[model samples]
Target: MTPRRIAFYAPLKPVDHPIPSGDRQMARLILRALEAIDPAEIGPVEVASGLRVYDGAGDPAAQARLSAAAAAECDRLLSLYAAEPARRPALWLSYHVYYKAPDLIGPAVAHALGIPYVVVEATRARKRLTGPWSAFAAAAESAIEQAALVLCVSARDRHAVEAYGPPDQQVAMLPPFLDLPPAIDRSETASPPRLLTVAMMRPGDKLASYRLLADSLSRLAAQPWTLDIVGDGSAAAEVSALFAPFGQRVRLLGARPPADLAAHYRAADLLVWPGLNEAFGMVYLEAQAHGVPVLAIDNAGTGTVIRDGVGGRLTGPTAQDYAAALSALLADPSSLHALGHRARAHVEAHHALPAAAQRLRGLLTGLMS
Candidate 1:
C-alpha cells in the first residue's frame, strides 16, 4: 500500500513563508521530520494542503474571514477526496497551535474526513479565554480538544496543554531539535570575549529582551567585549537606539541566513539574550550546537534550552543579576571555555535532528497503523 499522506499546516507562518525566523524554520524542520518517517521505507511521504490562512496579528475579523475560507477549502478537499480516495490525507498535522494563530481549518477538515489530527507546540492559557483574543483562544482550545495528540516541545507547554487539553487527548513531550551541523569544539575563548545575540527586533518580549540586554551590558561598560546582534524586524530603529550608547562595541548585523549566523556563533565565545518569557528560544540551541555558551534569564521557556552552569548561565530576571553573571564569566575565561565544551556535547546528545526524527517516527507510526 502507498504511504499515508500527512497534511501539514502552520497557521502562524506557512512552511514556505518568505521570512527567516524561528517559526518558519521550525515548520520546515517538522516537514522534514515527518517525510523522513516514511512508514514503509518507501520514498518520502507526501505533505498536502499548502493553503496559508495566516492570522499572525490575532485580528478577529481576519480570523473570521480565514475560517470562512478554510470551510470552503475543506469542502473542496472533501469533494476532491471523494473523487479520488487514494489522494486523501490520512492525517492532518498542524504546527504552532496557540491563541494568536489557531488551527481553524484542521479540526473541521479532519473531523469531516475521519482522519487522525495532531498538533505540535499546542499551548493553552486560561487568561487568554477572556482577553481580546477570546474567540481565537476558544477556537484554539477546540482544536486541541479535537486533536488525537498534542506534541509539546517544552515542559512548561506540556503542563499547560495537559491541564487544559481534552482528557482523552494524548500529550507527549517532543523536545526542540534543530538541523545542526557537527558540533564545533571551542576549547579556547576569543581574545576579547566575543558576545552574540540572535533574536528579532519586534515589540513586546523581543524588544524587552533587547532593552534588558542593553541595560545589562551598559552596566558592564568597563569590560572589553564585542557584541554582535543578528536579527531585524519592525523595531530595528528602536533596537539600534537602545545599543547606540555602546558605539563601536556593538555591531548590528541584522537578519542573516543560517549559514552566516552559524559562522557568528562559532566565532563568538558567549551568547547573551535576556529571552524574556520566550517559548523556548531556538537561538540558544543553535548557539550551543556551535559550541557557544549562552546567558539567559531562567524563565519557563528559556530554562528548557540553557542548562545552568552546564551549557550556559541561567540568571535571575533582573539587570543586576544578568550584569553580574556576565562579569563573572568574563573574569573566568577557563570556566567559560569548559562551559562551551559541555554546551556542544549537550546539544549533540539531545537536540540533533536524528533524535527528533526517531521520536516523531515513534509517535506517528501508530497513527499510520
Candidate 2:
C-alpha cells in the first residue's frame, strides 16, 4: 500500500536551524516525530512567515514594503498549493492556526484541495477577541470550522475547540511526544544539580518569565543548584541582566545544538519553566524522557505535561510559588530521584514517539480511507 503523503505546514519559520522560541522547537519536534515512523511519510512540508510587525527606529515606509513583500511571498506559496493536483497530498497538517494572513493561506489552500485539514495546538478563548490578537482569533475560528481534525495538547485547548462546535470527528487530544536522544551514562553525583530551562529570551512577556525565574532562583541562593539556560533571542541582554546577580549559579549557554541539548537533558535533574502561557510544551516530555522532571506553572496547557506530585510539581504562576516548589524539591534529593524515575516512566507509558507516530499514521490512514 502506498503511504499517505502528508503535507505539513508551519506558519512560523521552519525549525531547520536553531532558533529562539517554543513554536519553532515544536515545529521541529512534530517533523521529527513523523519522520521517526517513516521518513517518506511527510512530503514537501512548507512554512509561511506569518505576519510579523517590526516597530524599529528604521524607515517606516521600508518596513511597510518589506511586510508587503512577505505577504506576497505567502500568496505565491498558497497559489502553488492551489495549483497542485488534488491527489498530491493525502492530507494537510498545520502546526498553529491563529495567525491572520500568512497562517490562513495554507489552511485555505488545503480546504480548496479537498484534503483533510488537521490543526495542532489550536485555541479559542473569548478574551483573545479583546486583545491585539483579535484578528488572529477570527482567523483561528474560521480554520477550526473547516478542520477535519484538531489535535489539541491539553484538555483546556480541547474544550476550547469543542466550544467552537466543531464536527464530532474533527477533534483529537494528542499530547506532544518526545524523540529524545539516548540517555547519557553519567553518575548523578558527578554533576551538580543541573536545572535546565530551554527557551529563547524574546522581547516580550517571555522576558518577564525569565525575570521571574531568575528571581525565584535568587531565593534559592543557599541551594546547590545551577541553571543552564539554552536558546537566544532579542532580549538576550535583558535576560543576562536578570541572571547577573546569580553569578556562577546561572549559566547562559546560548542555543546549543540538538545533540548538545539532549546531553544537557540527560545530565540534568530537573527542568524549570515558569512561562505564563504555552500551547503544549514538548520540552517537558524531552526532559522526562531523560529521567528529568519538570517544574512549571499549573496554568493552561502546562499542567497537562507536569502532573503534581507524580512526575513533577505544578505551582501557581508566580515567582514566589515557583521558588517555594524549587526549594522544597531541591532540599529533598531522594524525592527528586523518585520523581525523575516516575517522570521517565510516565512519558514512556503515555507519549512515546513510536506510539504517537502510530496514532498519527492511523489518523492519516482513516482520513484517506
Candidate 3:
C-alpha cells in the first residue's frame, strides 16, 4: 500500500534556509522528524512566499503593499490546494501559529482544504491587541478550534490549547525532539570550563539576555571559564559589544553550520541560556546530546527541557541568580561532570531522533487510519 500522504506547512520560511530565529529551527526539526519517520509518507511541504518587507520607517503605504502581496501569495497557494485531488492529504500539519498575518495563511488554507488540521508548538496567551497581528491571531485561533490534533511541546502550551475547549483526546503533548550527532571525545581536550549558548541575538528581550550574560560573567571574571556564543541576529553588534569587556574570555562564533555547532557542543562543558521568555528551548537537548548540561531560568515552558539537579540547574529569572548558579557549578567540576553524563543519558533515552520519529509516525498513521 502507498504510504499516507502527510502535507506539511511552515508559514515562516522553507526549513532548509538559514533563518535567524528559534522558531525556524523548530520548524526544520519538525519537518525532519516527520520525514525520518517515513520518507515516502510526507508529501510536498508548502513554503511561504519569501517576501518579508519589515516597515522600519513605519510607512503605511509600504506596509499596505507588502500586506497585499502576502495576501495574493496565500490565495495562490490555496487555489493550488483546491485544485489538487480531494484525497491528496491524509492530514495537514502546521508549525508555530503566531500574531503575524502571514503566519495564519497556512492554517486558513488547511481549513479550506477540509482535512485533519494539526498544529505543533502553538501558543495562545498573547497580549498584543493592535493592528494586523491581533486580527491574524484571532483568525488562527478559530482555525485551531477546527483542528483534529494540536501537538504541544510544553505543558504551558497544552494548557493554552485546552483553554480553547478542544477535546482532551485531540491535544497531544510531544516534547521538542532533536536528531543529535554522535558524541565527541572531550576527554583528550585540556580546555578550560567552556560555556556555550546558541541563539539568535534579536532586539528586545534577546538583547537583554546577552546583557545579563555579560553581567554574570563580569561577576565571575576571576573564574577560569570561557564562553562561546553561537548564531547571529539584529543585535549582533550590541551583543558583541556587551561581551567586549571579557575580551578573549567570550567568543562570538556567529551562526556556525550544523557540523561545527555539534563539535562546539561536544567541546563545551555547559550551555547557558538566560532568555526572559521561551516557548521551548531545543538548544538544551542539542547541548545534552553532546554531554553538555544546560543552565537556564526556571520559566514555565523551560521545565520540559531542563531537568533540575539531573541534567542542569534551573535558577530564578535573574542575572544574579544565574551567576550564582554558574559560580556554584564551576566550583564543583565533578558535580557538573555528573550532571553532564545524566544529561546525555536523558536526551538519548527521551528526545533522540529515532524514538521521536517513531512517535510522529504513529501519530500520522493513527490520523490516516
Candidate 4:
C-alpha cells in the first residue's frame, strides 16, 4: 500500500528557524517523529508553511498582511502540487494553532485538494473571540472545526479544543516527548546544587516566570546554589535586571543549541523554572531525561510534564511557597538524588522518542484510514 503524503505547516514558527525556542524545537521534533515512524501506513511529510505571524503584540495590520501573503503562498503550493500528478499530498498536518497564530492557509488548501486536515495543538479560548485577536481567533476556530483530528498536548488545551470541536472531529492526547538519548551516569554529589532554567526571555509569561524566579530565590539568599539560565530574547534587558540582585550566583548563558543544552542538563542537579501558563514545557522533559529533577508550580501544562513530588516538586504559585520548597529540596541531597533518578526513569519510560513516534504513527494511521 502506498503511504499517504502529508504537507506539514507551523504558522507560528518554522521548524528551521535559527532561533532556539520551545515552539521551534517542538516543531522540529514533530517533523522528526513523523519521519522516524514507519511510513508504510501513515505518509511522507514535508513542511509547507513558513509564515511567522505570532508577534505577541496582536497588531491587526500585521496580522492582515501576513494572512494575505500566506493565502498567496497557499495558491502557489496548490498549483505546484497540481502540476505533479503522482506527488500530491494526501493530507495536511498543522503543528500549533492558537489565537495569535492560526492556520490561515492549510484549511483552504486541504479542502480544495480533497485531503484530510489535522492539527497538533489547536488551543481555543472562546473569550478571545472579542479581543484584539478576534480575527485570528475566528480563523483558528474555523480551521479547528474543519480539522479531522485535533491532537492536544495538555488537559488545559483539551478542554478548550473539545468545547469548540465539531461533532465528528477527533480529539486525541499526544503528550510532549523528545528525541533524547539515554541518561548519562552522573554523581549527585559531584557538584554543588546547580539550578538551571531554559526558557525564552520574552514578554508576558516568560518575563513573569523570570520575576517569579527572582522573587522566590531572593528569599533563599543564603542557600548555596548556582543558577544557569540558558535562553535569550527581546526581553533580555528586563530579565537581566530581575536576576541582577543574585550577584554572581545566577549566570545568564543566553540561547544555546540543543547539543550545548544537553551538556548543561547533564551537569545540572535541578531544573527550576516557574512555568507560568506553558503548554507542557519541553525543557522539563529534556531535563528529566538527563537525570535532572525539576521544581515548578503545578498548572495544567506544567503538571502534565512534572509529576509532583515524584519527578519534581510542584508547589503553589506563590514565591514563598516555591522558595520554601526549593529550600527543603536543597537541604536534603539524598532526596533530591532519588528524585533525579526517578525523573530520568519516568522520562525514559514515557517521554522518549520511540514512544512519541509510535503515538504519532498511530494518530496518523488512524487519520489515514
Candidate 5:
C-alpha cells in the first residue's frame, strides 16, 4: 500500500531544538507516536517547516515580524509541495498551537494544499484577544478555526477548545504520554527513601514551583528522605538558594538528557514537584513509567496525571498541605513502595507510547476516510 504521507510542525519549539522543556518533550513524543502508528498506512512524518512563529513577549512588533515570516514560509512550502506532488502531505499535524506560539504557517499551507489539517494541542485564550497578545491570539484563533480536528491534552484545555470549536470541527483528548522506561528494581531502598524532581530553573512559574517545593520540604525535615534535582537554567542561582538550607540532604545534579533521567527515576521513591500551571507534566509520566510514584500540588493539569491514592498523592496548592502529605507518606515507608507499584501499572495501562500511538491512529485514520 502506498503510505499516506503526513507533515508535522511545532511552532513553539522544534523537536530537535537544543532546549529541554516539557512542551518540547511532548512535541517530540507526539511525533514519535505518529510515526509508530500503522506505518504501512502512514508514511514517515516529515518536518513540514522549521520556521517558528512564537512571540512570547506579546509585542505587536514581534507578532508582525513573525507573521511576515509565516507568510514567507507558507509561500515556500506551497511551492515545494506543488513541485513534488508525492511530497505533499495527505494530512498536516501541528503541535502546541496557542497564543504564545501560534500555527500561523500550518493552517495557511494546509488550506492551500487542500489537506486535512490536525492540531495535537490547540488552546483557546479568549482573554488574550484583547491583551498584549491580541495579535498573536487572533492568529492562533484563526489557525484553530481552520483545523479539521483538535486533540486536546487535558480536560482544562478541552473545555475552551470545544467551546470555540467550529461547527464541523472535532475535539478529543489525547492524554500526555511517554515511551515506557525500563522497570525500576524497586528493591534497593535500604537507605533513606529518595525523592526526585526534574524541572528547569527558569524564572516565573518554574522558579515558583521550586520555591513552593522548598517550603514543603522544610516541613518534612524531620522525616528521613533525600532529594535529587536534575535540571539547570537561567535561574539556577535562585533555585539553588531555595534548597540551600537543606545542605547535603539535597543534591542538584544539573541538567541531564532524557536517557540519563531513567536512572534517577528508577532509584527514587517519589517524583515530587509542585506543578504550578503545568499542562500535564511529562516528568510525572516519566517517573511513573519507571515505577516511581509522584507527589504534586493538585490542580487541573496535575490532576490529569497524578491520581490520588492510585498513581500518587495530590495535596492542596499550599506549602503546608503539600508538606503534610509528604510527611504522611514518609511515615509509612511501605505505602510509598505500594504506590510505586500502582504508579508503574497505571502508566503501562494508560500513558505508554503504544497507547498514545493507538489513540492518535484511531483519531487521525478516521479523519482521512
Candidate 6:
C-alpha cells in the first residue's frame, strides 16, 4: 500500500508567507517536526491551502468576505480530491487556530473527505461570540469541536480550550518548539553590553510590549549598554521615536530574515523583549539555541521560555523592577555568561525539533486507525 499524505495548513499565515513573523516561523517549525516524523508512514507533509483566512481587524464585513472565501476554498479542495483520489490526504493538521484566524477550510473538507482533522496551537474564545468577531468565533468553535485533537502550545491556551472543547475531544500539550540554530562561536566584544530585541512594530499587544520596553530602558540610560532592534511594520515610525532619545545607543536594523539575524544573535550579550501577549516567542528559543540569554518581564508566556536564574532573569511587571533586575545582571558579568550557557542547554533539552517530533509520533499513534 502507498503511504498516505498529511495535509498541513496555517489559516493565519501560510507556512511560506513572505513576511517573517513568530506565527509564520512556528508554522514552519511545526511542518519541520511533522516531516521529521516517520515520513514513510506520514507521507509528504504538504501545505494543503495557501488561502489565508485571517482578519487582523475584527470587522464583521471582512469576516463575511473571509467566510465566502473559505467556502470557495473548501469547494476547490473537495473538487480537487474527487478528481485525484490518490492525492487526497489521510489527515489534516492546522496550526494557530483562533477567532481572529480560524481554520475555516480544513474542518469542512476534512468532514467531507472523512479524514482525521487535528489542530495545533488552537485556542477557545467564548467572549468573541457576542462581539464583532461573533461569526468567525462561532465558526472557530465549530471547527474545534470537529477536530480529533487540539495540540496546545502552552498551558494557558490548553486550559481555555479544554474548558469549552467537547468531553471526548483529545487535547494534548505540544510545547512551542524550534529547530536549534547552528552553534556560533559568539564573540561578545568588550564594548558596552549589547542588548537585542526582535519583535514586529505593530499596534495592539506588540506596540504595548515595545512601549513597556522603552520605559524599562529609560531606567538603564545611566548604564553603558547598546540596544539593537530587529523588526519593522506599520508602526515603525512610532517604534523608532520611542527609542530616539537613546540615539547612538540604539540601532534599528529594520526587519531581518532568520539567516541574517544569526550574526546579531551571536554578538548580543542578552535578548530583551517584554513579550507582552506572546506566550510562545520563537525568538526566545532562537536566542537560547545560539547560546544567548533572554530577559523578559514575568508572565504566563514568559514562564514557558525563560526561567529565572536558569535561562535568564524574569523580572517583575513594573519598569522599575525590570530595570533593577537588568542592572544587577549588567553588574555581574560572570552570572550573565553562566545564564547564557544554561539558556542554550535548557532549550536543547526541552524545545528542540527532535523532541517535538517524538511527541508528535506518540500523540499520533492511533490517529489514523
lDDT, each prediction = 0.85, 0.71, 0.73, 0.87, 0.88, 0.87
Q: Write the per-residue lDDT of candidate 5 for residues 186-299, one digit (tens) a residue.
A: 874436889899999988888999999999999887889999999999999999999999999999999998778878887788889989998889888888878888999889
Residue 155's C-alpha lDDT in candidate 1? 92
Q: Give candidate 6 regions above 4 Å deviation.
A: 1-3, 185-189
Off by over 4 Å in 2: 1-4, 17-20, 35-87, 99-102, 125-134, 167-169, 184-186, 189-192
lDDT of 5 at 337: 85
TM-score of each model, in listed order: 0.95, 0.83, 0.87, 0.97, 0.96, 0.97
| Most lDDT-accurate candidate | 5
Candidate 2 lDDT at 117 equals: 81
The digit string of per-residue lDDT tens for model 6 on 58-136 reads 8999989989988998999899988988789888999988999989999998999888899998888888899889988
Clashes of each: 0, 0, 1, 0, 0, 0
Pairs in steric clash, model 5: none
Q: Answer with 1 or 2, whichever has the higher lDDT.
A: 1
Which segments of model 5 are wrong by more than 4 Å? 1-3, 188-190
**160-259 in candidate 3: lDDT tens per residue?**
7887645644888878778777765555222478888898888876788788878888999888899889979778999988988888888888987766
Task: For residue 280, give model 4's deviation from the true position in Å.
Answer: 1.3
Query: Model 2 TM-score?
Result: 0.83
Task: Mark the 10 consecutive residues where model 3 has the least summed lDDT.
Answer: 49-58
Model 4, runs deviating above 4 Å: 1-3
